[model samples]
Target chain A: MKRIALLLWLSLVLPLAAASDAHREYDAMETYEPHVRGDQSLSGSYKHWAHPGKLDWRLAGNPEENWKLNWKFMDPPFNASVHGGHFALDRGEQLFRELNAKARFARCLGAGKAGLKGLRARYPQYRADLKRIAGLEEVIEYCAAREGRVLQNGSYDNSAVSLYVASQSNGMPMRVDVGKGVMRDAFERGRKLFHTRAGKLHLACSSCHTHKVGLQLRGSVITTPYGDAVHYPVYRTRYFLQSLHLRFAECNLDTRTQPLVPGSRAYTDLEVFMTALSNGYPVTVPSERD
Target chain B: MRSISILAGLAVALVLPVWAQGLPRDAAVNAAAPNKTLEPRVVTNSGRLEWLPHAHNLTPWPTLSHEDRRPAPKPRKARLAGPLDGDAGRGRDIAVRPDKGYCIVCHQIPGEEWPGTVGLDLRGFKQRQYADAAVYQQIFDARVNNAQTVMPPFGTNNILSEQEIRDLVVFLQSLE
Candidate 1:
């Protein structure tokens, strides 16, 4: 009887002890201050030599203006509004509504169309029940699974629906909570991963994004990580719509490091860290990029 | 009963190896065994046999997904003891190749278009009058001077060979 009582007492107390230890680690962590400000433009003064012939000479003096012109020039053909119909946006909206109807996403999210305002800004959130950091994509995948449907993380359908839902919260600032629990741990891990140098090049994400921000690399300019996450699920001329994790994988490959699986815990943790840096920046889905 | 069973088990264990030695060794198994003396097998890709660099051929580096317990290289300063005798032209070729030195990725080299501005412009590097050994050390490991430098340790990390570093030094010294 005494042994049974001791086992129960140990089980109850052990978990509490472990929880406090995690909290202590969180308390000891140094606060991360983003290097780049929200207002600062990521575009640098470097001449866009990737396609010199395509550049408008009039906007040459102002790199920001030149970038805008270059971005507009690279807009996909589907972006055109034919006879008052915005094809890309309409398709995205249609797919989103269809998925919502099938999966009851409106009920699951505890919001209607109007109530979904600022919904996109609150993602890469820590779920107490799930006991892991869940990105917007992961949450959507979970909801879809409940309805007996599968939504692959980086697929076109996923991107389309995500872009549409994210567009709803367009102008709202990101508000990822990293104050307590597993979120704090994930944030710490993400920051470490970003700064840690690995691979054949011995390059950290900070090497290009933080240290070499505004510097040109061959034909392209390096952008700051701050305010960068806001415009993700961005439509690129090279590969239509791309998820943030997909882009992370591409960066991993560029550094000659084998990429972690998309939507994996490590990548989700990284997304949490990255999105937290853009805390004050407004979401800008359906954004185009060259 | 236990002693009789134990005796039988001991007898089987003692006879097992001896009984196996009487059998002929499989020729295929002997052929399949790894031999250090044998040349690396060429892989056939799209109907063409090529000596591509596989995981076995490449130098082991610390990768993101893998946990590397090896101690990281510390910043150190070392100089060549003799006069540099590397081919400047060959060095220039290596500097431009993306897979090799690719110095133009971060440094502005003369005659190179779309040069990156992350590192110092080497247009008049000859005028700096830096010692050849100093330049070699900087390329090998810039952390010896600046601990927070973003430049890759080309020599120390095995990204560039010592001869390649010597050639790069010669090429960098020739800039006027």
Candidate 2:
């Protein structure tokens, strides 16, 4: 009888003890940890992401001076040699830049002067023609299509343009209109999606991103969605591609929940919520990812 | 008396066939009659069983020994790696092994909360091209073909040893 009791006690105590240890380790990592990038063990300054207040706003104007872009984002794959040979920025990236500049300068749309800078701070607003709250990308797409310029898909170049243009507005206060009618309805819809629980895990977008912002998950910190929306067409190192909407769509699918379609109403609402969260935050387009 | 005499005649007549039905050998013979040796059977590729002449030769039925001499075809080479033999449950756990290195850190996977949306989903990979060596190469060294990829060669990274890579290869290959 005594042996049986002891066995039960040991079983209960061991798992509880292990569970506490795991929890403690995770809890302790909430603060920033010094990370090693390449050869140097960057002090808390270089590797650590600065708070929104510390970011320099001047670099947005100079196209050449954007240091945040990484070599991994710029380089071609090794296997591409099977093509003609290993190509350089002189081949693809340069053309990309030329097209980008031409698109901006053409201003074929009456959406007003190249006013993309900081325009992300005021998106998912009520558009008179659509009679619905539309995301910044949607408006851009509409303008592109109506003005007779070839509109890139909402999930594609719009995302890229959003990032680049929003970067110019970094540090600006988010100013999405929350007035009555279409604007209010869209905002509410976005809020509902943000807060609604779904998926096998029964988690909401706010569960991890909102409640746990800056909380450590493994080695990385949880970035808040508030200021994150300001950077569109984020150029991540993993795919070495530029498409913020692609990243956004991937996140929803990864949530283990039923994935919302890329250009669907749910994503547009989610975008509204995200952009509104960072309403006051300045844009940082084409930001580098680790 | 007339009715009784008629009934007695009928009863005697019914007993013989009823008694024959109880015989085991007769029953077995009746069961086997449908598959009797004398009847020719045709086996179609569609598996439709048809009773037809079995002999293909006009001169005489070919000997059983002649039919058995044909050689079998060689099996095709596997394109994708079969599932890894290491712990599948452990493989699932090892797949999420942050200590080993999180695949989701670079790759965007559905159902993981707040994962880095950097690479393609690793799910449904087996369906793309079910080859073991291809999977091994993908997990081992993606840079062998594409250096521009942000995916760190997990095996080459020294984060996961060769054995762990095999285990992960098994886990990823098991995904739908």
lDDT of each: 0.62, 0.43
Candidate 1 on A1-27: residue-level lDDT in tens?
Answer: 455445555554554454334210011
DockQ of each: 0.12, 0.01
Identify the leading candidate in terms of DockQ: 1
TM-score of chain A of each: 0.72, 0.58
Query: Quick one: RMSD of model 1?
Result: 12.5
Q: Please list, in the order the candidates appear, how each scores on TM-score for chain B only.
A: 0.65, 0.47
**Candidate 1 on B1-176: residue-level lDDT in tens?**
55554555555555544432221121001223342111112111111111212232111344333122223455657678687989999989988998889989888898999888898998999999999988999999887887667788887778798889999999999999
lDDT of 2 by residue, B97-170 (tens): 56554676645444566554345666676677656676666666665655333344555434466667777667
The candidate 2 chain A region of ten consecutive residues with least summed lDDT is: A23-32
Candidate 1: which stretches are off by over 4 Å? A1-61, A64-94, A106-115, B1-59, B63-83
| lDDT of candidate 2 at residue A214, scale 0 to 100 | 40
Which ranges of candidate 2 are over 4 A from the true structure?
A1-110, A113-118, A147-150, A154-156, A167-171, A241-244, B1-176
Q: Candidate 2 at A3: error in angstroms?
A: 74
